[model samples]
Target: MVELTVREALRDAMAEEMRADGDVFLMGEEVAEYQGAYKVSQGLLEEFSPRRVIDTPITEAGFAGIGVGAAMAGLRPIVEFMTFNFAMQAIDQIVNSAAKTSYMSGGLVNVPIVFRGPNGAASRVAAQHSQCYASW
Candidate 1:
């Protein structure tokens, strides 16, 4: 068996998927030039270019809504938040729009998107960043 950190595993999986499908792209804050907030997306920008590996502003809802829209248009989007706590800012886009659109459209619209990020507590982080929102 091969051992890999969570970051490496995620990067490898995304890279594999992107290599297999042209529509698979990754988007999030600092995922490109910054190599991800936790370095999980290291080297993806160089391999996929800015077109596939995109960096967005701090507005989570904005980018997430874009991801959902792209998914509805037949693109597979991977959205990475800096932390799951911040994902609350985009909850409407994730839960209401992306999660509900397929049923709302009677299976005519399919949202193929993935939202990924670190979650729960960590050492020396701010209080707001330390709370676990995964179970909520």
Candidate 2:
């Protein structure tokens, strides 16, 4: 039997998808230069180049929108939110742009995207950091 940490499994999935499809790419704060805020993106930049693994500012809504737009353009985008709680800032985009782009566009646009979040704050934290990733 083989066992893998959540981070490992997520990384493997993203890596495989990127390798299989040139249209698949990952982008988020600290994903490239910082190797992901949680280290889930540790070796992606080195393995796939900066073009496929991108780094952005700490603007969740902005990046989420960009990811959704890219997905609408026929590209698969993986977006990481430092914490799921903060994802609220971009929830509108996820629900409207990423999830319903095709329906809203009368099936002309399909948003193929993966959204990952709630990282580095699962214990004794407060406020938005108090999110539960029970089965993440």
Candidate 3:
């Protein structure tokens, strides 16, 4: 058995999937040049280039919505939120759009998108940043 950190596992999963499927891509802040905020996407941009591994601006809502739209268009997108707290800014796109699109479209559209990142508490983060919205 091999052991890997959460970050490594995430990177490996995306890498493997992208290799298997040409339609798989990733987009998020720090996902490219910075190797992800938590380093989960380390080396992906170098390997896949700007087209497959995108690095977006700090506009979470805009990029998150774009990812949802891309997924609806038959591409598999992996949208990363630096932290779950930041996800609140794009909740509508995630909850009402991406999550419900497949059902609303009667299965005609498959939103094969993964929205992920470090959820829950951060060791030194403050109240606004450390809370876990999943429990609520």
Pick the lDDT winner: 1
Model 2 Cα lDDT, one tens digit per residue, 56-131: 8889899999998898788989998877777878989988778887887898878889998754456667876765
Candidate 1 has an lDDT of 0.95
Better of 1 and 2 by TM-score: 1
lDDT tens digits, residues 29-104, model 1? 9999999999999999999999999999999999999999999999999999999889999999999999999999
Off by over 4 Å in 1: none
Point out where model 2 deviates above 4 Å: 119-121, 133-136
- In angstroms, the error of model 3 at 23 is 0.7
Residue-level lDDT for 72 in candidate 1:
94
Candidate 1: C-alpha RMSD to true structure equals 0.8
lDDT of each: 0.95, 0.85, 0.89
Each model's backbone clash number: 0, 1, 0
Off by over 4 Å in 3: none
Worst 10-residue lDDT window for candidate 3 reads 127-136
Please provide TM-scores, in order, for all candidate models, with all chains considered together: 0.97, 0.90, 0.94
